[model samples]
Target chain A: MSILVEISENLQRGKAKVVKELVQQAIDQGIPVEQILNEGLLSGMSIIGEKFKNNEVYVPEVLVAARAMNQGTQLLKPLMAAAGVKAVGKVCIGTVQGDLHDIGKNLVKMMLEGKGLEVVDLGTDVSAETFVNTAIEQNCQIICCSALLTTTMNVMEDVVKKATEAGIRDKVTIMIGGAPVSDDYCKKIGADIYTSDAASAADAAVNVCS
Target chain B: MIWTREQYIAHCNFEFTGREMFCELFGPLLQLEEEWRQQGASEKEIAMTAFDWDYVLKTGLPCRTGAVTGLKPIILEDTPDHTLSIDNMGRKSLLHKKAATIPLPLEYPVKTADDWLKIKHWYTFDESRIDYGAIESRKALRDKGYLTLFSFPGGFDEPRQLLGEEELCIAYYEDPELIQDMLETMADTAIKVMERVCDKVPLDNLCVHEDLAGKSGPLIGPAQVNEFVAPYYKKVWEAAKSFGAKIFSQDSDGNIEPVIDAFYDAGVNLFYPFEPAAGMDMVKTKQKYGKKFCIKGGIDKHVLRKEKEDIRKELEYKICDITKGGGTIFALDHRIPNGVSIENYRYYVNLGREMLGLPPIQGEGWQRMAF
Candidate 1:
């Protein structure tokens, strides 16, 4: 197999240290940085994401693969910056107010970064005002809200309403997901999208950003 | 005839305890109690008739079951709506003080082998950790038909509490030694502590709790279960089983359907609060496992937020054959969320009990779980 395929396989198996070493080797061999990133790192993570959605792999596997991808990508950051390769889009994400749970939120953030988008993690218990202000100031194309509580999920609507009032509703896409979030609820709250799992959420965000 | 907590467990194991029984593994959200009071319930009425909680009695034996016993969280910051605290285990979390939601974990206790070594001292079995007086009282209660449970952190859950979710999963692959040490220390600690408890009184239910699954399935699969969990779990569980823990039970949330065999193979004969939204069906599970295993919760908890007719429909379909078939303790899949009002909740309990042919409730729906 090719060196790029080797890096992808190692990453999928969660061999972070090995993936880093192999990525550096590929870099030294004069492979294009974007090719190494797209073929070596993101390609592996994309497969993990698909596996995660289909239950072929689970949280642990997905998390480690994400970690490995991050490891491989860390080596390419400077080179990519020199080459002026830009991210597809930027997004801001958080768990909504009164809901402190963040496992799902963090997973989606990693998947977003895996999809070559810059994600500003606002952390948990984020209010609607903060989400809107952050998106406005950061010039993000998408805002993602997550809540794990039935009580706290109502805050997603406030986020939607705030974006509308702030006049960014038309400018930025809104994404929502968590244990209690649904496509029907997303529509009811006037949010743009709701995907069931992290991979699908990343895929949806890519769609919105593009 | 009324039966001991032991007998109730026995009946669920297909051992036939004179009569079939109706019980639950959990209670209302307790945060919803304030709302219940606002909905015209007197404080006295609420206390006396706490959804008939004791009617289908399952009393957990007051033994020290946490990673480290008797350590309260140290307050670091106090806001009007949230609190930032470091738990005794040295994990930092942000709490939504008013809402009573699970605190968002900001930092975990263990990150590396050195971190595990720094904290390993806390896992030892100390005499002070055992609650002797509470154990004596609950032990007496157990013999008098209250199902007494000897509950502890499951092998997977113990390490997860120390390592946090993300690190724990990665540690299973990258730092196998750290995971093994954590699991081994916990298993040894469990055995030593449980031996002392069993010497005082026999345990009816050996309850291992691991909130290890999600809407998708278990965080770790059967392969991980066999690799990281089962070997140590088997040691502690078998010791409890040998010590007269009639039912080896586990409590996990979200689609545990996939890993039931891993748990069963490790000697768990009973499970609780099987989430329906996550695809756990009582009828299908019964068809598969028959009466060999016991299931406590499967009724859709989300349905309680809806109208009475919806609640009735959910119950009628889920419980028609579950209760009569044996090896079952009827309950909602999880706690009652705050969205469910007192009136709707009472209707659920009363209507649920009536459907199971259990005793009905008193006026104003302040009755307990038992008749």
Candidate 2:
């Protein structure tokens, strides 16, 4: 089998060490960096994302595969940069203000990255102004906001309002999610989108970016 | 309306009371206290009125069921809004004093087998860990007509304490042997502790907090739960049941419907705080599982944010039929969030209380029962 296929299969099995070694080996063999990324790393992650969507696999599988994908991608980062291979999309994501909960936020960020989006993680307890300013500064097309608390979800409305006040509401797609958010809430806040789970969020982001 | 322990036990087992047993299944969120104070109607006053009017109360038996007992959390850093602390499990967490959110786990203690080996000694049960006096006090607490429970962390929850949710999720696949060993050892310790507690005082309910699901479904589906979670539940629950514990209940915050059977089949008969926003159709759950399966909380909290009419519809949809034959307790799916008008909240409660045939919550001798 080709070395690229080895990286994909090893990453799927969560063999992080093996995947890292194979990614480096693929580089040494003069394999195109983009091929190793799209075919090797993202290919495996896309499958994991689909499995997660279908519940054929669970969180642990996705988590381990993400760890493996990270291992492989760390090797490809500078190479991809040198080749001038830009990300398909860029986004800034965070758990909204007054909410320290980040488990769901982090999971969504992973799924977003799995879809080949360059993510700027603003981390937990992030404010609306930060989400807006960072997205503009980083040239991001989408802004993702997450909150686990019902009380904290009010901040998501502020995120949309801030984006509108900053005159970028039409330019940036606002995506909202977390345990307390829903389709109705998305519509209520006038955000661009809301998906129930991380996999769907990633798919939605990719669709909007494309 | 003051049902004895006999009535509460009977109601849990699917016996119909004459009307809905007046109860609130979950506690108020501490984060909303400031809002409540601002509204000029504290839940404390509401709770006092609830009891004066014969509301059924619930509380837990104080039990130190952690891997290591008597180990206090050491504050690493203290700030105006948050405090960083490390516990016996060696996890570093940030506790927000002002925000009612849960402590965010920063650094996990157990990742690999070597880490498990290092912490294994803490889980061992000994005479020093036992508090016979506390057990006796629990018996007195139960005798006060509170729906008393002996609650502890479950298989998934205990390990989640050592490994944060993300790490624990990955560890299930990465380190099955370590997971199984930790669970089995914890179960052994749990069984040991429950055996002694049950021996001293008769058990009303034996509860294990799993918190193992989310908005989509259970974090792990039935197959993984069967392999990883249910076995320990089966063994430990059977031991507690053998000690005359009448109810084996599991507490999970999100949609547990997927693995509910796994827990039910493993001897757990009751569940709580079922979040309706997460798609836990409690009425459907009741129809599917029948009267033998018990539930505590299923009222949609989002309704409390809507019109008074919407609140009535949501409550009637949740409370009416499900409570008809018993095995159900009415409560908001989760905590009352900030911004729900005090008027709306009181309306929801008094309306529910009236539906249950309890006196209005307008305090002593006030006759605004149908406002």
Candidate 3:
């Protein structure tokens, strides 16, 4: 198999050791960094994302797979830097203001990063202003906000409003999610996208970026 | 001072006893802590801050109570700032400025087997920690013709929190023998804590808090519950019942309906914070169980963020309709969030009180769950 395909398979199986070894082997073989990344790590993550969305796999599986992918990416980082490979897109993410939950946000961030997006995690309890400012400063294409509580879920609307008020709404796509958020609520709040889970968030972000 | 089940239910004027009523005052988890920290509040202050309590009262719900299960302290060392430092299950580690500072315990008390060993030794059965101040305050309120209840703590998740989820899951699988070893250790530690607390305080009810589910369902299957959790629950339930406690309750989030029979068999008379997300239908569950269980906290947490009318409609549809002939407590399915405005919470609280026939609090609406 091609070195990229080998890495992708290892990642899909959540074989951290194999993923790292294959990534190093790919580097040793002098494959282009972006090609290795896109074909190997990102492709594996894309499959995992779909599996998760389709309920073929669950959170623990996704998390372990992400861990393997991250390990492989760690090995590819310097090579990618040397190749001057830029990220596919820059995305700013956080759990909305007043919410301390991070599992969902972290999952989304990891999946995004696995897909080769530059993820600027604003961390949990992020305010609308903070999201807007960070999106503007980071030149991000997407502002993804998460909330685990019903009360804190409303902050997604405030985030969208603040993004518009800051005149960056037109420049950035706002995606809101969490346990309590729905697509109807997303449209009601004027968000650009609403996904039920992390994989969907990743696919939507990637789709929007492309 | 003597109260029968009917009188107690009448006093609260709600069907369920231990359920929580939530008024969504805010949207999904916002950084209220950072906002508080930026406002120059101490970490203790930030942790103790209430979310939309005023609005919860305004809603006029019959019950108005919140539990403090997530206030445990964690000692973080060598963790970097900005990057999230979590324990194995991805729960955020507490950041304390000083080691000497005794912050409120927010998370689970146990972390590792070694940590559990250390805590087991250092764990004291201090009856004084039972928050008699709050109990006394409630007692006073009750004396003055207002109904009140105290929160219960410790359950299956408590041990899991101490042992970590991976270790516990593994213990259940590869090291079945170790499950007993760990459960014995946890049971002893918990028994001591319960004995200590019950000695000093007149507990309204003893609650066991265990979050045994994910979005899909319970983490452990039913057979595992029978093997690992049920025996320990029986022990704890018997201990609590022996101590003159009237209600022995278990608090678990998600659709715990699958194991409801096990819970009842284990002597848990009440279940709190019945998550609607997990498809816990009180009407159906009560019908199936047939007074074998007391239901609490079945209202969906999501409804709190809807408009006042929607909130009312759901209250009538989900809560009132289902709980009509059952032993039910009116409460939010989970914690009140900051996204719920003060006004909306009050409206819900008021509605809860009116429905349950509880006396009106001056500022709040109606009352209160999770594991």
RMSD per model, one decimal: 3.1, 3.9, 9.5
Model 1 lDDT per residue over A59-121, tens place = 889889989998998899999998877898999999998887778898899889888899999
**B221 Cα displacement, candidate 3 (Å):** 8.5
* TM-score for each candidate, following the candidate numbering: 0.91, 0.89, 0.62
- Native contacts kept (model 3): 0.04
lDDT per model vs. reference: 0.79, 0.78, 0.63
Sort all candidates by lDDT, best to worst: 1, 2, 3
Off by over 4 Å in 3: A1-15, A22-61, A81-86, A149-155, A179-184, B1-120, B124-184, B192-206, B211-248, B252-269, B275-293, B300-312, B319-323, B334-371
User: Which digits, one per residue and each the tens of the lDDT, describe model 1 over residues B127-215?
Assistant: 77677777788777766777666776677888878888878888888889898887788777788878888777776778788878877
lDDT-wise, the better of 1 and 3 is: 1
- Global fold similarity of model 1 (TM-score): 0.91
- Give per-residue CA lDDT, model 2, range B1-371, as digits (tens): 45566676787798876656545444456655566667787555444343333344455555556677446888999888888888656677887766655677777778778988888878877765567767767777677876666665578888887877888888877788888988888788777877777776666778788888788667777776888888888887788778777887777888787788778878888888788988898888888888867787788877887899999898778766655667886667666666677678778878888777666655531111100
- Measured against the true two-chain complex, the DockQ scores of the candidates, in the order shown, are 0.58, 0.58, 0.08
| lDDT of model 2, residue A63 | 85
